[model samples]
Target chain A: SAVISQKPSRDICQRGTSLTIQCQVDSQVTMMFWYRQQPGQSLTLIATANQGSEATYESGFVIDKFPISRPNLTFSTLTVSNMSPEDSSIYLCSFSGDGKQDTQYFGPGTRLTVL
Target chain B: AQTVTQSQPEMSVQEAETVTLSCTYDTSESDYYLFWYKQPPSRQMILVIRQEAYKQQNATENRFSVNFQKAAKSFSLKISDSQLGDAAMYFCAYRSRRGSNYKLTFGKGTLLTVNP
Candidate 1:
């Protein structure tokens, strides 16, 4: 399993401001993904951060709202833009190694609160 | 599209006893992967066990085990010797077996409480 860490473990921001969460992995990985979990709700995929190319956003999410950066295999960042109270949730970053479809590890998750 | 379902919203067990969290999924593909992830009160999710559809034998990890029924499309997690640490939210997840870009579809989750 890869050791993953997310900066700004918990944060409170103004409704109109933006906050960027950083995800760092101890080792290089092939696949990295972002997920959002609303309070008391199941997790939903936000996007897939691809190295070099643009991040693949999920249906309900758009690049304008949630921008991602994957400059390398071991690092990625997700920024919540134009934040709203609705964006208050836990954001998680996960990754899977090469040829390891059955194993994906999750980060500790960043808790965001917009007021 | 694949969908994972965890029917039990909540469950309870006595310390040293056993508990099973029910999970079912909707998928037409034969080859895939099923996983059980545990999230404690602290909300750090971790993989408990995983089962490959192509494998007939069920997967087990120490006290955690999975009953994967391919035909029935059922995957349940059985935790033996339940401990206080086992009290957490358990989520069932599914991923496609064929694709390189495999995104996980997760169930709502089942919260388990261990009574001392």
Candidate 2:
């Protein structure tokens, strides 16, 4: 399993402000996924980030609001734009192991609190 | 659309005792994967066990095991000899085995409390 790390474990931001979270995996991976977990709720797939290509966002997610960047195989960034209180959630990044083992490991997660 | 359901919102067990977390999912696909992930206070999702839909045998890891009934669409996790460390939010996830669809559908989660 690749060791995953996310920057700014948590943050408190004001409404209308934007925050970018960084996810870095110890090893190179082909596919990286971003998920958002609202307080006391389950995880929802925000988008899929693949290196050298634009991300694929879910139905409710948009590139303009939740932009993703996959500069390399091991690193990706997710930025929440024009954030509101409803955007407060824990964001996680995960990747499957070479897409063979049928498993996905996740990062520690970035907890964002919008006021 | 695949949907995973965790009926119990919370569960408790005494140390060294046993506990079971229930999960059910609806999917038309025959070949898929089911997983149990634990998210502790630190919010790190840890894979506890996994069951391939094609396999009849249940999946187990240490004291954590799953009773998978494909016909009933039920995948329940049984934790024997439960420890305080086992306390966390358990989420049931479903993934398709077919083509580039590797995204997971997760349940709301059940918060487990292990009391010593």
Candidate 3:
């Protein structure tokens, strides 16, 4: 199991502002993913942050609204751009130490409240 | 694409009793992984147990065990001697083992309330 730490465990922001959440892993991982859990909803995959490349987003999400940056194997960040009240949700980061196994370890999660 | 479904939204179990949470999945791929995660009031996701598709024997971790019925595409978690600490929201997840995607498809989750 890998230890994942996410910064800004929670934050309250204005509707038009943006918040950047950071995810740091204790060990180097091959694949890093971002997920969003809206109120009373299940966790949804936001994007896959690959090191040294553009993030691959899911069908319902886009890079413009959620920009991701992965400078290296152990660190990544997800930025919610031009936030709104509907964007209020818990953002979680996860990664797998062994690529083929597909067992992912998740962070504590960042609870974002957009006012 | 894979999807997971947890039928029960809420369930209550008496302490020292046994409880089972149902989970069903849809996937065309034969090789995959199934996981059970627990989220308490602190809102941290904790891995409870895992099941590999290729393994015939079910996975068990202490008081937590899984009944994996591959033919039925069902994976349920069984908690024996249920304790107060076992009360939490449990999520069932499925992952495809073939890709580098590492994306987990999760169910809506079942909130387990343990009565002491």
- Using Cα atoms with residue i matched to residue i, what is each candidate's TM-score against the true structure? 0.98, 0.98, 0.96
Q: True contacts preserved, each candidate?
A: 0.79, 0.93, 0.79
Per-residue lDDT for A1-115 in model 1, tens only? Answer: 5799998899999999999999999988987999999999999999998788999988999999999999999999999999999999999999888457457899999999999
Give the Cα error of residue B33 in candidate 3, in Å.
Answer: 0.6
lDDT (C-alpha, whole model) for all candidates:
0.93, 0.95, 0.92
> What is the descending DockQ order?
2, 1, 3
What are the per-residue Cα lDDT tens digits for candidate 3 across B7-115? 9999999999999999999999999899999988777788899989999999999999999999999999999999999999999999888856568899999999999
User: B38-92 in candidate 1: lDDT tens per residue?
Assistant: 9997788898998999999999999999888899999999999999999999999
Query: Which regions in candidate 3 have their CA more than 4 angstroms from the true location?
Result: A98-100
Residue B95 displacement in candidate 3 (angstroms): 0.6
What is the overall TM-score of model 2 with all chains considered together?
0.98
As for candidate 2, its clashing pairs are: none
Model 1 segments more than 4 A misplaced: A98-101
Candidate 2 lDDT, B9-96, residue by residue in tens:
9999999999999999999999999999999999999999999999999998999999999999999999999999999999999999
